[model samples]
Target: MATADTMLQTALREPARRLTLDLRAVTFFDSAAIHAVVRVAERFPGTLAVLPSRQVRRVLEISGLASQDWFDPS
Candidate 1:
């Protein structure tokens, strides 16, 4: 969670219009991590794209976050 927040903070400091998070290697993540990602996406709006792992996908689905507009699977 802390690590994800730190990474997101650093990434947001950059001047990119879009942020693509390739979370395919992340096999495990808790709600805190999900919260961090969702916060970032909320801050950036349509600029967030998430390529989530199967586990992450399940978590998002279970958390009802997968239906969010910012949860781009592609």
Candidate 2:
């Protein structure tokens, strides 16, 4: 999970005013990814959004990270 951790670290350090995760082409959304999204939201607060792919939507939804409470899809 080194790659996942690195990706998460990179995202956490982003200086954007808003953070949008476009997972529309992602085939795999694991716990690490889920944690990353949560971390981003915690860091950016209302500036977090997500566009998850159909392939990984179920995983994200089931994980309780694909919701307006977690992020707004924009």
**Using TM-score as the measure, which candidate wins?**
1
Q: Rate the local accuracy (lDDT) of all candidates.
A: 0.82, 0.71
Q: Write the per-residue lDDT of candidate 2 for residues 1-74, one digit (tens) a residue.
A: 34567767887887888777776787777787777767777887887667778756788768666665644443
lDDT of 1 by residue, 14-56 (tens): 7788888888888788977887887788778988888888898
Residue pairs of candidate 1 with colliding backbone atoms: none
> Any idea what lDDT model 1 has?
0.82
Query: How many clashes does each candidate structure show, in the order listed?
Result: 0, 0
> Worst ten-residue run, lDDT, model 1?
2-11
What's the residue-level lDDT of 34 in candidate 1? 88
After TM-score superposition, the amount by which residue 29's alpha carbon in candidate 2 deviates from its true location, in angstroms, is 0.9
Root-mean-square deviation of each candidate, in angstroms? 1.4, 2.1
- Quick one: best lDDT, which candidate? 1
